[model samples]
Target: MTQEKYYFENPKSSIRSLTEDEIEAAIADYENGVKISEICQKYPKLKVSSFYKQLPYKLNQEKCEYCNNQIYTKVRKNGYGNDLAKLCIYCNHDYTKNCNCEQCFHNTNVALEEKRKELQIVWKNFYTEYYNLNYTLNDISIFDEIYLVLLIQSYKGTFENTLDFSYFKQLRFQVHASSHEYYSVINNLIDRKILIPNIYYFDSYDYIYSSEPSLPTINSTKINWIPNIIKTSGTLLSVSELDKILKERTYSVEDKKILWREVYWSEIKSYIDYQINI
Candidate 1:
């Protein structure tokens, strides 16, 4: 008979992982303000040394210029431990209490962007294949995730959200997604109960106030959560302005009409704001 050889564990060593009690005790001490160095001294055999080693920069901590205490900062690109500390954690928190400081704002933005990236990873495989789908859920990129949020904000009713295909088409270019791929993902979401089909409204610009009306109503909320923020070329387009541009331009001359539908998103606000500045 052949003896068993385990793949993940070392065959030569008799050591096994730490017990639940020991792991919990270590975590309790670390979270209560014990230094990593001290934790290593106590838990050398627990294999926490590797984790501490990866965070070498955090070890050097900077002293707050005002409070004269050690602080850790993630925004600073400098080596973790060697980062120049302008303020300790306490002082920094107090200063940004109002959230007006540029440093704090930048740091907050950094954090939001990190979260978006993290979500992108989470959404990477959220789609399923139980329904005979060709694409997997992980195909979702950062853009799709952002658009889902925008769609939620744009929805006006209790049951579902709606946007004209044309309006979505304009956005497709910015995110580098084609219409086929976009609809495929959307249909998948709908199948999953993540979306619902609302009553159909015309998306054409010419319908105006007539029985067949199609007007574009873009959302005007500036999405501060967008991390770097994406701005359209012009200011926000109001109903009146959209009507004027639609008539003035050749949009009416085409054989097929591109109607406007209501939409809620950052571009709606950002566009109007940009035009106002001009």
Candidate 2:
């Protein structure tokens, strides 16, 4: 009599629940290169991430060829699953165990060659413009040329057009220059208005005497040294304008910046090579 009490619930499935047949159809569509969004529309109950998680076991479990780890089964119709599972996220889609077949090697070299030629053209054009801008200043020293190129390269290569002032100290070591010579060269560039601070104009004396103002003397309220982020302010082609001018020749400002970065980085290394032993 106690066991006779029973409850009946509705037979409708939850929003996340999918029948086996629906899952099978979704998997078939995904394997055939259908977009995940399209599949989600076809089966409204599907969650992309959850559905993707289930993909690892959808077909027979297979080991990753590169990492030797168990992952999703392969699909011959399209290698989307294989690419998702095997490609290294950190390496820009390069396989962990890179393929060394002749085709792969040839493809890699051809891509590099094309990139090199493109960068060479960019360098030549920019160098011509840079030279034209500073041609009036005949006193441009070799160190000035090298330092300007390095600064442009760093501004374009780094995440932001900003760096710690101490970075120049590290560059001095890299280029085998003394502290005195390094600061002298920096001052020279600053005097020529090529390198300008990205921060507000401040006098070092304010930080040196940060004490409260007395009857006769006034001092800054701040106590810490202000950090400086240097920017390239070229006489002919400022860092801001360089990318804009180059954008006409490239895909975008970002792509042009990358090409400029590559060219200047190579130029910096070449300068370092010659200056290292001298």
Candidate 3:
């Protein structure tokens, strides 16, 4: 007998992709409690694992609490080196500080202006007492009082507590006043003996008093005899101390007095008392 003829054949199978409709159907069936093995049998071209990978799932993202806009979150550290709160992506707003977005800028400015107004009231009250004690209350003008307060506030503890003449010029721009107004205030303060010429640069008093016939004008002029640096007869409070005083809610007159130079407080109190009695 002839040897039995044997034939072996290998069948080629191509992967058939599932359409969008087929994928949707599979996803629906899978979500409806259909077994993975059954679904794989139904679509044998792709594995159940592949089908599961294409399934939809909920995303882990955060939304802005204010506007419900999508925001990215990041892990930040706090002062103690711990995890901080989530920051808003749009406004840069966080739990720690105010938002920097344009929408929030108006509120921030309003808050700052309110704070400035409050501080102004406090400063006005604080300096009004000082102004009344130093000058005759009846003769005191709010304009002059404000100028005196501004001068004291601008004190920077320069040489022998002297301030540069240029600061007076700059004050005109700061308060939207004319150069004449600022200089006039300075002249008044000088004539009242509040601001004294810094005589430390002079070898003797004769140079200032040398019968040169000084003509006082409120406006800036070309005068060679004008002093560039001026000082107050009494020591002025330092900027840092004034800042501290401004921050504190309750500061006594005694506390304010102590802020001055130790040597001047007694004399200041004595003068204040004398003026009060007068």
Best-matching candidate per lDDT:
3
Ranking by TM-score: 3, 2, 1
Instruction: Rank the models by lDDT, top first.
Output: 3, 2, 1
Whole-model lDDT per candidate: 0.36, 0.42, 0.43
Query: What tens digits encode model 3's per-residue C-alpha lDDT throughout 1-278?
Result: 22211111111211125565665576567656678779778887756554443443221156666655444332221123334245454465443556566556767778767655554454344334433323232243334434544555564335434444545445542322343222355554545544443323333222222222232122211111121221244444333433343345354577455445443654576678667769
For candidate 3, the 10 contiguous residues with the lowest summed lDDT are 4-13
Stretches of model 2 off by over 4 angstroms after superposition = 1-16, 48-54, 59-278
Candidate 1: which stretches are off by over 4 Å? 1-98, 128-278
Clash count, predicted structure 1:
18
lDDT of 1 by residue, 1-278 (tens): 22112111132321134354654455456445576567667767644434422221121244554555554432222234432323233445334345434566777778767655544333222312221232222333333444454443443233122333333344432322332222344433444433322212222212212221222221211111111111254232222332243345433323222122212343475577667769
Better of 1 and 3 by TM-score: 3
So what's the TM-score on candidate 3?
0.27
The ten-residue window of minimal lDDT in model 1 covers 220-229
Report the alpha-carbon TM-score of model 1 versus the true structure: 0.20
Angstrom error of the Cα, residue 7, model 2: value is 34
Error of 1 at 79 (Å): 42
Q: Return the TM-score for candidate 2, rounded to 2 decimals.
A: 0.24
